[model samples]
Target: MTPRAKTPRNSGQRGGHVLRRMRASTVYLLLSIGALVSIAPYLMTLNAAFKPQSTLLSTQAWTPAVPATWSNFTALWSQYDMSGFIVHTAVVAGTITLGQLVFTTFAAYAFARLDFPGREPLFWGFIAMMMVPQIVTLIPLFLIMSHLNLIDTYRALILPYVFGTPYGIFLVRQYFQTIPADLEAAARIDGAGTWTILRRIMIPLSKPILATLATITFVNTWNSLLWPLMATSSERDEVVTVGIAALQGQFASELHILLPAAAVALLPLVAIFLLFQRHIVRSIALTGLK
Candidate 1:
């Protein structure tokens, strides 16, 4: 059979497809370039982490660490007491994450499910707190901590954060609101209380969002510098971010040591993201839909 004639309409359709493909290719090319630009520093840091101070200082920034040594990692672990910093960071980040998850779960459940006087107004007011920059509350928080004589204490780090955050509440609440009311109704028919319904139904169903909130809280708490710096006076109580800064000061000229220390500080966050990335993406999509 003869092939169909190349009609003007078919030609136009083919041309439109070509144009669309070209636009997509251009978009992808730009995105790839942007990704490489963003990742270049981290690549440099990874390379620098393994080199000796002499080599790093002598070589260009982009050069890979030839004959890579574990010395930087060793020094960071031992001389810098990175273990202590890691432990402190873990404690603070873990506690804050747990607290935010628990408290925010309940708060979100309440706002989404329970009937209360002025609930909408209260929730809106709480969300309004998100609009206020955290720096605005720094002075008041410092004064309160000072009044309680909690400065330089773990209480100072953990206590202030454990109550829950506005963003966490909002994210979880949005997810919770998406949950079917029928589930709660069925649970109630089975004599389930608010806490039980939350635990067995809402929390379980909202895993993706909770994971997202937990990951965010953990990363933020772990990377926290300004607050931890002000709250804790001594090196013993400082988190990894502050510890890394102090480590830089001690090894001011040592790129090898500083980069490795920064890399070490980054490991937990990297691991957390790799582990929960699916949930994080799902949560974002879910939140957007809601």
Candidate 2:
């Protein structure tokens, strides 16, 4: 009967459809604005990196009347030891990422698939620990490092990563749950041990999430300032973030130098994200599904 009434041209239905589309368009516009707002700082950094010191510090619009100079980059590379900082950051990030992934994966597999007394309680304890702020453990961790005589060494940094991260274990455990038990069962039926099953079956299926986690861990460690600052005082042990902050302190007046140094510190992460963006997106989706 309502459809029959619509024989009068269905203007109301058409109007409703038009209104829905308009609402959708408005939502898209709002989202676009939000995205632009989020991206503005990075855009400004990029532009300022290319600009001269006077222009960078000035309150002019993003684009200047005159062409930008490459002297900023040259000065930063020569004076700030940016290349050395990059290598240091890469080493720290790589070591931490590998340590976290391996230990976390094993711990996650044990918690998820293995049977043991008090396993559930231990896993829950780990979950509870995640609720505790990292600040609470900083003093204790420092004391432990101090006692071991590992201060200012790579061991001071790498030892903390060897035990596995609560976040990493939690993330991997959630992913492991999504994996079919049938695969594990088949491997076991074929006399494959737990290690074999995990390495051959579970790990292979979890490439996306693993890649994403590795990327995130690398970025985080590379940008870590507080711990690196506390752990290592010498420029020799400096990571990129601490190096950039140090550079900022040294070149206070030279905005051109400072901005370009900051840009250099950010470039590796930006490049990594750009290269692995698709993998990151897929891994995030998979992680969410878990």
Candidate 3:
């Protein structure tokens, strides 16, 4: 029996498949290169963090930290009161994150679920705040804090931001709008109050977006430098960013110490990202879908 002849159609389809595969490979290659480019600085910083001051100047920037020393970390912890700065940063970041979650959830819920006169106008007006840069409000915030005699206190750090940010409110509100009204109606039919429905139904269902918002708030607050620097003068109230900047001043010529201090400041954010990465991705997808 004669074998079947290859047709032009079959050959054309095979060529199309090869072209698609080539395109995909090119895309992947470009993406991988971009990822490496983005991460190169972090890699260099990590290498520098463990190198000695002498080695840092002599070795290439990309060189791995061989025979890594612990002295940089030791000096940071022992001499610089790194523990106190870490604790203060943690306290401020944790408080801001918690406050944003609670306040933003409630505000978003009200905007998303409830009907009132001028509600849309009010929400849009509030969200317009997002268009305003923090620098615009910086001087006023400082003056207010100073007038209230809260400068250098945790209150100065936490109180101003605890009321919920415009971005947080907008994000949660968008997520809340995606939920079906039937859920709330069913809860109401069962005599569940607004607070009960929000606590039991909305909050649980919106955990992914909430986690994303919390992680964002935590990282932003932890890395905050300008506000903390302006508000607090003493070491006792300073956060990790301020502490790291101070390390730069004290060890002006020591890249090894400065890099380690910066790396240490980054650890908590890295841990948080690793823990909540899935939720963050989900939240991003949800936002895009909405």
Using lDDT, give the best candidate's number. 3
Scored by TM-score, the top model is 3
Residue pairs with backbone overlap in model 2: none
Clashes of each: 0, 0, 0
Which residue runs does candidate 2 get wrong by more than 4 Å? 1-20, 59-61, 64-66
Instruction: Name the TM-score of candidate 2.
Output: 0.89
Encode model 2's per-residue lDDT on 64-153: one tens digit a residue: 526778988998887768898888888888889898889888999999999999999999999998899777877888899998888888
Can you rank all candidates by TM-score, best first?
3, 1, 2
Error of 2 at 131 (Å): 1.8
lDDT (C-alpha) at residue 229 in model 3: 90
Clashing pairs in 3: none
Candidate 1 ranges beyond 4 A from true positions:
1-18
In model 2, what is the error at residue 99, expressed in angstroms? Answer: 1.3
- In candidate 3, what are the lDDT values of residues 1-290, reduced to their tens digit? 99998778688889999999999999999999999999898878888889887788999989988989888788667767888999999999999999999999999999999999999999999989999998898899999999999999999999989889999999999999899999999999999999999999999999999999999899999989889999999998999888888888888886766788888887888899999999989988877834
The C-alpha RMSD in Å for every predicted model, in order, reads: 2.8, 3.1, 2.2
Q: What local distance difference test score does each model get?
A: 0.89, 0.83, 0.90
Candidate 3 ranges with C-alpha deviation above 4 Å: 1-5, 8-10
- Angstrom error of the Cα, residue 133, model 3: value is 1.1
